[model samples]
Target chain A: MDKVKLGKEQLKELKYFIYSRGFREPEVMMEILDHFACKVEDKLTENPLLSLQDAIKEAHKEFGYNGFYSIKASLDVFTRRRYKRIYWQEVKKILLSPINLLILLLIGLCVYHSMKWAYNNGFYDSYFNRNIVSSLIILIVVCTELIKFIMLPRNNGRSYHISIANTVNYGNFFLFWFFFPSRKLHSVNEILVISIIAVLCSVYYYITTLAHYKMIKAAHKDYDDFKVLVENENPLQ
Target chain B: MEQNQFVKGSLATIILKLLEDNGRMYGYEMTKAVKDITANRMNITEAALYPALHKMVADGVLSATTELVDGRVRKYYSLTKKGKKETANKISALRDALESVQLILTPKIANG
Candidate 1:
């Protein structure tokens, strides 16, 4: 058996392995591999029958792959739980914050005023009261808004997830206006204003969602390249 | 070897114990020590060792220092005070477990 030397290639492979495995500390990983190589070399000196490859493999097996995986899995579970706890804590902070709650209350008041206007003008009684079609449209709009509110961050950051959420939100609004009873005795000016709002929302939604989809695709591509790097380095060993 | 079917639970203890005895060691040295002590009966892969070491550091069970050696900077891990105390507890637990099992399995000798 040829003596196992820690060559440049092996170091590179070890570095890639540690990085791919999500250690985040490449310097520490290299140090560990150096020690592992030295130990394997020492074992080789004692037992000429034991090959370097076999020794390394034996050392790793004693460490136990499944054992390591379980530890990692537990850590992942712990981290996820910690993240959830922290997320809810942040949400609690946001909800409890007087300014945020005041803003939310003001938005609620705006929505209430809009509903009251729709009710007083006989728009709600005429168009929405008797027809299941109008009711369904209202339901769809509400559902879309609820979903958007849940999925999109409150701060209105232009993230891909938020953009997709907004698109669904606007699409529902457009559907609502398109299906609204236009033949009723009402002002065309109000209808036009609402239609314009819907159109603007739809345009923003469309552009943002497209940009978000492109970003999501790019991220996946980068991750795929990282996976390929791991496979190339390890080569089933 | 099969008696120790589950290895993950003992890894932190093993690492802490190794570092407690050795003063300071890197990932590979720790792995090698465990393997050599087990006489090739146990193995730990790079995948397992790095994450455990990283987590240990994160959790304050270990402290690390980095130095450049042989054209590469290597990080070495040493036990914290908490880690040393934890290692003592682990050793006691392991010892108790072994004793209990041995007591249960030992055959009584006939009085001659």
Candidate 2:
């Protein structure tokens, strides 16, 4: 059978149904709208006599007593879970990838030797100086991500994934922040080990920032796709 | 015997294997395909099917692409490379499970 196409008004009504259900996230909205429309059309074909409204009702019922809300719920959980996976994948790449390995080694060696240099020069002799530098570096990394978020356009297709990815940047920030005051700073080994950790904190921040950058790029692509699709569907618009 | 639990448990594998054979399928097409293949004996409800599809997409076991077809934007799902490998694993594991179940469900009269 040829497809029983929906009218523009019917499509608007479908959009209203999806919007009213609180699925305002652009990606989620697009996915759900397309999926629901496909199901609604399937219903209409199975019963040629059924009106669009009737078919929509039947299709919604196929989602069970909970209706499309259940699918939305699944999507919500899946979104968070997916972002978490992305965060770890990006982190693993930075920590283990051969390309990043040399950088990591360089940073580690630099920090280790600098701490030794400072200790011999008496810069590390002051507790206030030691904590102040670590604290400032952590603050700077966190601030940079926040600043980028503020600078991006409001319609950047920002989503939970971006925030999740940024959170990975802060993964080791608290470790150094809280661990600084309690450290046994009497020995060369102790201070050098702490300096290596400082380098790791910076690396962690870099990984998260890059992941967030990729997500933002993807968001722009999605928005562009939606724009082209909309223009194609309604030429006058 | 009816196998609602069996069908439910094997849903991911069933979907993966179907996509492996068919190349690409949409949500409605999948339900109909299942109905046709089983001659209406088994039905994969929308509730079960959509969640599975979305989960597979999230897990990278499947990839979804959208195209305007029949004057409607239909999201099509197909196996990713990971999904193809997973399909093979699931098929073999399911086969092993079915054999184990068959051993208990039936027995030769006297080793014929």
How closely does chain A match the true chain A in each prediction, as TM-score? 0.40, 0.70
What's the lDDT for residue A199 in model 2?
73
The best candidate in terms of DockQ: 2
Q: Score the docking of each candidate (DockQ).
A: 0.15, 0.49
Interface RMSD of 2: 2.6
lDDT of 2 by residue, A1-237 (tens): 887667767777777777776765555655666667877877787788998877877777766677666666666666566666665677676777887778767766765666556555555324455644564565676687578768644453434344444454445456656655433366767777777777776665566666665555544565567555553423221
Native contacts retained by candidate 1: 0.19
Write out the backbone clash pairs for model 1. Answer: A32-B28, A59-B43, A60-B43, A61-B43, A62-B42, A62-B43, A63-B43, A63-B44
Candidate 1 regions exceeding 4 Å error are A1-237, B1-9, B19-25, B36-89, B108-112
**DockQ of candidate 2 compared with the true complex:** 0.49
Instruction: Judge the docking of candidate 2 as incorrect, acceptable, medium or high.
Output: acceptable
Question: Model 1, chain B: what is the TM-score?
Answer: 0.81
For each candidate, the alpha-carbon lDDT, in order, equals 0.54, 0.69
User: Candidate 1 on A11-74: residue-level lDDT in tens?
Assistant: 5554454456554432224334555456556566668688556766654454455523444454
Q: How do the candidates score on chain B by TM-score?
A: 0.81, 0.92
